[model samples]
Target: MTSKKSDLEAAIDAAARILDSATTIGTLGHIGPDGDAIGSSWGVALSAHKAGKTAVASFGEPFVIPRHFEFLNQEVVVPAKEFPEGLDVVVSCDSASAERLGSLAGAATSAKKIVVIDHHVTNTGFGDVAVVAADASSTAELAYRVLQRLGWPIDADVATCLWTGVVSDTGRFQYSNTSPETLRVAAELLEYGVASDVVGQELYERAPFGYFGVVSAVLGRAELDADLQLVSTALFQEDLDSADITYEETDGLIDLVRLADESDVALLMKSLEPGSVMASLRSRGTIDVAAIAREFGGGGHHNASGFSFDGVPEDALAAVKAELAKQRR
Candidate 1:
């Protein structure tokens, strides 16, 4: 009397059951949350509200919300300092691993259940219930499906959040991950009156003047490797200080490096703090940066990924170059 559930349906059903059973749920994104992370976390929390469940959206780290994503409803996202206590369940979105949960790792582990909904190839299926959809364009897209499968309302506000996630992760549908299904989902979201131009302007056109200064300084430090196939640059804390910019401003600079005509791999290394280095990798689709990032204890999509190093920028760059060389060979 019943038909087999599709894989997507099964996963959504599992996630929905977990969500429905919880009286109070906490939705968390990874540390240094990005557009997809913020979008997915908020989308899930909002959907929970529509389903008559109490939910909160939050991140473990305290960050100045990126100016581009300021359009997100601030009221729905709980500040790190204000994270509530005694949540019955915690749902992590867009994060691949438990350790990457930052300050919320402890709470997630201590909670009654930890549900992981993500679209990362590197995810190892952690948590009490894992709904990982690597083929999906973004976690936000999967979050939408979870809401839809559960028959939850996706109002215009929720549509905007999911749209931002899909757009950001797909590079406005320029990335290779954009599929017919992705476009279809996007088109449906547009029906909810999602303001595409406003999102585009905020994400791509509203860069502060200080961003250009930082990009210039970092490019000046760029170095091509022996094969000239790898282009790398470094941004120290002093560089951010001198330019009066924050770490978030360097978001798109790697795109400039990845587009280099002569390079196959683009690497951006930043000194987030003393003895701590963060490296973001982007490729022209010839390489799987996610695999390389994993070698350095990081994970992400195939074409883009990042990892943090426990040493100086030079040391991190050297390790990255060595791993890249090995991978290429």
Candidate 2:
């Protein structure tokens, strides 16, 4: 077995043992709590709760929590702002690099015993224990597998959380990482009484009125590479302010670009402060968008990724165009 896989297996084992003995546990995901973040946090929390341990799933900013995750509405699962004292273990879920962890990163660093579970490409062994799978699609999927191996068992609520993470991370099974195992996990979660239809509708079938409006405008103006495999669009602050768009509004825009028939890559440009531009990059196949994102001081998964800009959206678009052209061969 590879060292990375071995390390993950060992961490899962240790986590199970911790659950067996720990009294108080704190759990959290990265700042922009996506589906993986929500699912991993809730799945781990629910698992610990099932083991009769006191587990509170902590999240970052309010907007980071997606609307679809309203199903995870629990009184005990709250924000990471007011630190709970005397917790024996603090587990960071679905967060790989500390840089993406926001203010909660300090909490994890200062915890009595910190555990990190994630599926991002940038994990650098940043915890007392690190369980990372860069190719796992979603951290929630890994977390569920861990709990299962620990004999903690997966429940209905846990299944719902797990499914949400998987579904979101895979872009409703549209991403290249979707595999037989992913479908298998989805089937298993269904057996646990997770309403797949509810989760699906919540995730895929709904978008704000402003969301479609912005997408319509972007699509109308999107540029295409010669092969039509690369699509590019620009978004101004005026557009954002007019639609009351938040960072979350850009969540799936990159996905749309990748789906364009002509392009292997998609780029979305946004203006920073006033004169700066931030860019997001998404690609299919073996191209590593994360590396491209790193060039712009942002990082994420290989196929689905993002980056911030140093100038206006137009300038950011120009840089992204150069990068995409450079990758064509």
Candidate 3:
């Protein structure tokens, strides 16, 4: 095995031991919990519970669980508004940087130990132990390995959570990041009776009616720069207000902007609160969007990455366009 893989295996072994010995474990997902974040966090929490350890799942910020992910709410997931006292260990799932952990960073500091489990290429490698497998398709995949290493039981609930994470991060196994190993893990998850059809229906086919209005407003204003081979769209607070949709409903809208095959880069800028904007970046070719995201204090996979800008939509778009132009030159 390569030295990098060897080191990761060692880290996983160490992490498993830490988790197994902990009497109370806490899992923190990124600030804005997506499918992978929620899935991996929930999966890890469930694994700890199955192993007879106390576990709690929380996200950095208060968020309305996206409609598709509501099924995961069958179990109580604590909000990070107040960090529980006396957490023996804290694990960060699917977050690349400490900043992305939001308020959970404080909780992590108070914990006796911290472990980071993630698949983002730009991960900062924080925490006392990091099971950062950039080659893995998702954090859920890494969590599966860790659970197996710890000899934790993978009940149907755990299987379903991990499977949701795997499916989402791999784009339903269609993203280029999907590998044979990912497929094998997914196959095993299915053996635990994961309902593939239900997952598909909830994640993809069950968007709310208001989401379509938001889509129309955003995509209707999409702009293409032929010379730069870039397609971009900007959504303002007014758009969300008019569409009667919340920021959570804006999930998956980037997929529409990325449909321009002729473009090398796809960009989406969405207004968040008053002075903040979220920039979603997608690349169709050799361009590494992760590099761009890192430049703006964020990180993710190469093909898909994102950053939050402390500015308005127009400024965020201009900044991204300039960066793209510089990268092209």
Candidate 4:
């Protein structure tokens, strides 16, 4: 008698079967396109192209790639409008839910087959074939496994993309999610000529000159909730304008805010626009920030998570504080 395949093995097989018969493939990441999103999407899209499939990678509107990820080959990625219709398969990388795809959610829904690859605990299992592993360090790690299962070649560029995802999502291997398997995957990708030093410098060490000013202003307004052991801050559009910094440049701000020795939880609220805010949450392992994020219709891992708010930053901050207070009690 044949044994039942593990979930991972089953997903890999299902995804490979669909991909094997596909002529056109579309790879998508979540809105705001973080490193894991970009890396995993491109890793699959590039491999698909190398395998003689018509492929493209894209995110939603405001289709901007962070400057740090400029090293990735831009040709494989197309703007949302240019993403072809009637794809044989659509692969979603790192997005926890279909809504997170923003405008491109329709494309995924309409695809002949949908393969969801993700590591977020909040993933909704929306795809037809989900390669979801909440315990995996990052979607990039899962993507690497899927590629290996398919016998797809991991060229230098592909390895670089996958490596970026693992590095960024693991907090340079310092985050609690970093597992032995995560390191094993990283080591294998490195063998394909991934320039780890260059990836590190681009992702962490460099930012535009204006970024420092923005960080200073945000840090200046940071607040601490001693009882809740939480540190929080807000960044407004004016703050970005004052420093000539783009919204994407603020991605690193949470890392700085979460450094407070007195706090186990950190929150950074950024104004996406008037009456709209995005809250980023981080934990030093004591609090389950992901649950807090899910309460606000968002999701993520235990240590890191985020959600969007349809109110001013002040209101959003108040709501998050109230939630944290509730969780603490």
Candidate 5:
């Protein structure tokens, strides 16, 4: 019996056998299902299906990513609303806990085996077998590695998913996570036939009308507390309705702020519902925002974290400001 503490390379070999023998495999991504999460989930699902195994993706929540992601769906992802049964294995990607599994918890728990793969710093590895890499820029990177080990070449489609995961998590290779190894992995992915042009166009070149408005509004209203080395921005419910976007669209907004020469931390908040606002935090150097997020009922990596609450954008912004203020003093 292979112990759970086995290395990633060993785990991938073991996982391939488990996947090949499984009658059915269910793949899942974390809540909000951003580029990295969706890309990784789809990568594993597609690779498994191509290998003659039944595979499907679950949103793990009520979240719906950009319609552009329909490219990755390829008629395979089962809506979170639908419940499928008799799964031989559940492959959880980029998720630290089952709570992140949301609507599909029942199926995951009932599966004969659960394969956990992720790169989050806060991951607790709640699965029968875990394959995690703290040094990985994104789970898509891990998926790419796993598929290569399974003797599968990175087809154009797989390359697209890998690229999305890399661009999304690396803030388009701008974040500190984009190590030489990250670029090396990316370079190999391109060899597998990933198109960089299409990726750049969809993610960077084009944007909905309201996207510009929201971006403009956010920049105009964005505040910087240089003394505290923090920058913050917020949006209201009107902003959400004006543009057909999800949390994924706002994924790297914090990183945008962190790009500043002096900013050590970045904060982005948007109205979720009547009074609820969603918060995403990003850090550049040594500061940890995970503790800050947990103080408000959320959790994530040291430099990246999230939270939600009922309140006006400014009010919640004030609270976060106070939290950092305490740190400054």
Candidate 6:
């Protein structure tokens, strides 16, 4: 009797075959690509190049690479407009849904084959070959395994990209998602000459002068609802404008807000534009923040999740608080 392959294993096998036969490939990450998204997409693209395939990697509109990830090689990355049309294969990295692909969804949909590599629990499985592993620490880990399975060479630069993804998504291995396997994969990548110190310094240690001002402003108004075990804060456009900061620079602010020992949950709401808000949610261990995000047409892991709102920050906060109230009752 033959044993059935796991969903992830079967998906990887199918993706390898598709990639092996393809002459041209396009890779994309989600909009406002995070370290995991950027690293996974580029890692696969670099690996594809090593295998002697023509590959392009890109993300959706507002295609700015965040300041922290500027060290990554952009050899294969191109603007969405520059991404070749009618590619033989399209691979999406770390995007939970087709909608998250933003302007590039059409490219994936039109491709002869689509491969989805991700670790998000809420992934919609939107590809011909879906390697979705909710248990994996980061999509980069899954990407590493897929490349290894395909017998692709992971050079030092490739390892650096993958290392960034693992470190970022795992919160420097402090998040609950970190497992022995996660550390093992990271160790292997380090063996490939990944500059761990550079990654750590760029990602966590260094920030622009303006960043301190923005942090001060956001922290000043932080609220703690001890009864609900919730700590929350809101950042308006003025906060960024006054500090000469961009919305992207506020990514690490939630980590500070979530440090309140009295609260098990933390929420950060930021103004994207007038009447538009984006939120980041974090939980220490008690709450399933991802379920809350899903209620608002968003999704993520159990501890960290987010959503966008069409209303003012106050209304968004009210809605999230209401949901938390319901959960407690």
Question: Candidate 6's residue-wise lDDT over 229-296, tens digit each?
Answer: 89999999999899997877777999999999999999999985999888899998789999999999
What lDDT tens digits, residue by residue, belong to model 5 across residues 1-329? 12343577788877777776787888888877878888998888877777777788877667576755665535457778764766899998888778777778777888999888888766777888777877788888888877877775457787788788888888789777888989998998788777788787776666556666667667777888888888888866666567766445654455566667778888888776778888988876567788778778777777888888678778888888778777666
For model 6, the superposed segments whose C-alpha errors exceed 4 Å read 1-5
Candidates ranked, most accurate by TM-score first: 4, 6, 3, 1, 5, 2
Q: Write the per-residue lDDT of candidate 2 for residues 123-204, one digit (tens) a residue.
A: 6667776777777878877888878887775788888888889988998887877888888888888899998888878776
Clashing pairs in model 3, backbone N/Cα/C closer than 3 A: none
Please give, for residues 1-329, the per-residue lDDT of candidate 4 as tens digits. 00233867888888888888899999999999899999999999998888888999999987888899999876789999888767999999999899999999998888998999998878888888988888888999989988888887789999999999999999999887899999999999999999999999998899999998998889999999898899999998988898887898778999999999999999999985888999999998878899989999999889899999999878888888888888787
Looking at candidate 1, the ten consecutive residues that score lowest on lDDT are 1-10
Residue 20 miss distance in model 6 (angstroms): 1.2
Model 3, 1-329: lDDT tens digits are 11298898999999998998899999988988888999999999988887888888888775467778887644637767755856899999998877787877788778999989999888888889999988899999999999989989898889999999999999999999899999999999999888899989889897768788888888999999987888999878887788787788778889899998679899999885889988899998578888888888888888999999998888888887787888888
CA RMSD of all predictions: 2.8, 2.7, 1.7, 2.3, 3.0, 2.3
Candidate number with the higher lDDT (1 or 3): 3
How far does residue 86 in candidate 6 sit from its true spot (Å)? 1.4
Provide the lowest-lDDT 10-residue window in model 5: 246-255
lDDT against the true structure, per candidate, is 0.84, 0.74, 0.86, 0.89, 0.77, 0.89
Candidate 1 lDDT: 0.84
TM-score on alpha carbons, each prediction: 0.95, 0.88, 0.96, 0.97, 0.88, 0.97
